[model samples]
Target: MRDITMYQSNGENELFVEQSVAQLPQLSGDTVTATIEIDAGQTYQEIDGFGASFTDSAAYLIHQVLDGEQRTELMSKLFDPQDGIGLSFLRNPMGASDYARTVYSYNDLPENGTDPELSGFSIAHDEADIIPLLQQALKLNPEIKLMASPWSAPGWMKTSGSMLTGQLKPEHYQVYADYFVRYIQAFAAHGLPTYAVTAQNEPLYEPQHYPGMLMLPEEQLVFIRDYLKPSFINHGLDTRILCYDHNWDRPDYPLTVLEEAAAEVDGVAWHWYGGAPAAQSEVLAAYPGKEVHFTEGSGGEWIPPFEQAFSNVMRTGIEILRNHSKSFVLWNMALDEQNGPTVPGFGKSTCRGVVTVNQQTRELTYTLDYYALAHFSKVIRPKALRLDSAASNELVRSVAFRNPDGSVAAVLFNDGEAEETVAVKLQGEEVLTFSMAPKSAVSLKVDSK
Candidate 1:
């Protein structure tokens, strides 16, 4: 008999696991009621994992506010598969992001000077909070994959001569490429090696207050093909390069890069702030050989009523995975009560992290984003493949996965306000029948026999 482990969400029971139901005889039916069909035999993208970012602000909260024991507990909840959500992928900033305590970069230079040799490059600022926090998370889940993205090329490398808005100077192209090499080497020296790196964060959007560099598709193509690729080869670094770390609204950016510098890029990273999730599949259809990654989206102070936040994340996870994205990552792992320790005048102050740590009370509160992420990260692991699954109607949405252990995990979300009775059929055989609460997310796991 195959046992089923189910987790349900209403309001109070956010991702709460219900008692397991013992297996029963498979039902024979010609006409089925509401049903979700799972075809494990048909598989799509191989999942890398699901997770959030580990920013300086988040690191500060973990290191300064939480005591040693509390820190351990929180880290376990965030990283450990057995003890917590088992997030297997993490996004790291190459330097300061809007979420950082202060705005800075690894290679800050005087306005009049440029670091052609990059002699002054350093990651000293990260050691204080970012490195230690990452080390602790690694201890909890050594297999976690870290991908870094730069908010801006250092001030001197840009035309603006500041960390804010600027474009990379034409002459500094090779030097900027070397800058990335130095960053990878510096992090490796500290025992935190990055697995992948995006060319720029929100490449098209350059804000006036914080660190941002606008790299047009043509410029990015030239840099990757002529400079960055050669630098990586010379250094013998195998870190994967992802392009167009921007919104789905601009699929042409990635498509253009793929057309011109396909040899230099491994995949495309997308942000959900402006486009539809289906746009990812469009890119995949155009270039089936390339990968699609959903890199950033978040729930926070700007999001209303916790339930809506939960639903938004759950819905997004289902849609992206169904659309061929191998990985889904949210932003900001943790933050203080004020929604930050954010860089003033840089980004949205109302932005929220996955979890909030009260500055005064030093207490931790897990946001809806945490539970939303847990529904997938807790069951679907790294290296798993997305199995084909389809709901009978729009009211119910789901994505199925075949794990390395040969088990099957299907995450289902009910959109309606009333309860839903869903009969799950595996390979045309009725495996189980369960009721889903209105506006709930569920992760159903079953052993493959």
Candidate 2:
């Protein structure tokens, strides 16, 4: 038996851990109990220490799994305070992705105008599923930052004249720019203001499956600097434009675009399917001031209880954290047990979402991804910057932050096979030291300097 205690550097407060493991041989299970001890003079991090964001994947999942009362309940869990993920950011498709039931874009009709202008364009295509879902999400967290990305432009705008192509016709440059402006304004009118928009999703790849369009680095630069930027300004839209909405494997795409266009774009977004974790480091090295966001990717197709062990969640969570990502938005928020609402001719594969909704029982199944995200979302609140921390060689990784409330918040994880001890310091003073359990994540809150 060991005694675990946490203390503040100023010697003002202390917390003690209390444990009560079952003694019965038949019912014994591995369990560690943590107890909090507070001294009279102690202060800790504020409740709004960390923030998180969510995505539009919840809508399709809700439609497929729950209906009416059931849908509302699940939505609350995603946005409501009692159980909501408390998301402050959301990612929505400009048109349709593989996650949607069908494929379509905001302006997917045949039309032509040299430097065509979208004077009468609207978002009638997304009204069915994306709109209603976004309204409910906003109702839950009005502060949520919405981001829009086009899986593919309107079919007619591409050189291939289809969603699955690698080029956008130069003839429609002005029209395409107007298309973006219309999208932002339309979504805003619906009470869901988009905070950001990416030039093109996976711009480097044109899939023959679902909706996808590839835009070259030069094309992106021209579109953003010469067309999109001017269009946004003309429309008086505040939504920021992000470039390179693709995988880490092609950091050069965003790098080249931003390096050449300079201040034309606000930031760069990356996906996780094509490259290793270290790929972001290359981009970060080149563009330090720019924001690097992990916009999409799912761990796998299932969420098992054992997967909750740090190796699966904590390990990967730390990797993303260490990569200098301001935020991490997983692919699907909610999905049916079978993992679908899949579009025809998309990818040859499917993956799991954060929450698994049982259509038959009206029961909600939260995955390791959900728990892992909660560990950060519940404690790290939005706009919180990554501070600093030190840990061992095991799978555990840690990051600290100085909260606006004059307190510090630190998240530590042990994703390896054995438990380890960690020491945390705030303002160069040792405040607390604790032995992290194997396969577990813990968040420490302490008063700021």
Candidate 3:
């Protein structure tokens, strides 16, 4: 008999640990309800972990608003595995993102001036708020993996000479690469070394208001193969470079980069703003050697009643992991009551963070995104491999994993209107059976026998 710990979420039970069953019924074909067989023998991509981003706005809320005890409690609730949701991965902005308090970059320069030598490049802007918050987060979970992505390069590096809408200038490729090297080195100096980086965030779409830069597939390939790769080697930085931080609508973008600059790139990063999650699997099927990562998704004011947010996030998370995404990241970790401290002209005002902090009262409210993340981040440790699992129908969606510690975690979602009695079978043995309430997400963990 194996002890099984079950955590469930519907509307009422928010990641609630409903029970701890000590045994399983004898395997009998007639007794089995809906059997979800977990095949540990077969494994897929190694999971990096699950988490959300530490955006500028998120960091600001943590640093400026919350008191010492409240901040400590919040951090513990977020990063502590035993005490809270063990978020083992995080995405950091290389500079000002749309969620930032203001628009800025590391290598800002005066009009008509060029810093080919990168003498003026500095991460000083991030030092004020972002770094301190990151430092505390690292203190909570030293093993957390951080992946940085820049919304835009410095104005001088772009053809438009502004951080709004433009493409990276061909002449500034080498210098821009150097800028990345310096950014990584600076974060290391601050004791928060970056683990990986995407070349650009949403490279295909460049918004006219917020910080954004358009870099087509061919342009990204050249930048990686000729400039970024060599720059990392020269600077002795092993930070992995992921390409095409864009939507799934066009698989050709990443496919082209992989076809051309595969040697220089580590993998592909994708966002859920447009297109289907299955596109990730398409890229992986073409290049099985490379990795696939779900970089950013968000929930906010746009979602009504909040429970729907959890269901949506859970469905997306399961779909992506089932499709071979090793890492899953949501957008902002924290935001104010109004869903911002957003920069003027930046779209997505309705986009809320995983958690909302009251600027005036210093109160924190955890959204469905947090509970949805907890379903995965709490049990699935880094290096856990995706195990083979299947559902009987679309109403019952599931993805299983074999943890590094020899435990198996299966996350199941019952999207239908009626409760589902699921029999989770391991090696054809009915290990446990439970009723997953309708419109609920549940994670069941069992020790390997």
lDDT of 1 at 413: 92
Task: Put down candidate 1 lDDT per residue, 361-424, tens digits, no spaces.
Answer: 9999887888888899888988899999988867899999989998889899988887777888
- lDDT measured at residue 34 in model 1 versus the true structure, 0 to 100: 56
lDDT of 1: 0.86
Worst 10 residues of 1 by lDDT: 23-32
- In order, what is each prediction's RMSD in angstroms? 2.2, 7.4, 2.0
What lDDT, from 0 to 1, does candidate 3 have?
0.86
Model 3, 1-449: lDDT tens per residue? Answer: 78678887867445655554643334455544466888989999999988888788998898888888888888898898888888888999888888888888987889998989989888887787788878887788877888999999999888899989999999999888989998899899988778899999999888887999999999999999999999999889999999998888999999999998989999999888889999999998898878899999887666666667777898889999999998999999999988898888765588878889999888998877888888998878889999999765568898999898999999988878887778888878877777777888888888877
Q: lDDT for model 2, on a 0 to 1 scale?
A: 0.65
Model 3 regions lying over 4 Å from their true place:
22-33
Clashing pairs in 3: 300-352
User: Candidate 1, 205: how far from true, in Å?
Assistant: 0.6
TM-score of 2: 0.81
Q: lDDT of each model, Cα atoms only? A: 0.86, 0.65, 0.86
**TM-score of each model, paired residue for residue:** 0.96, 0.81, 0.96
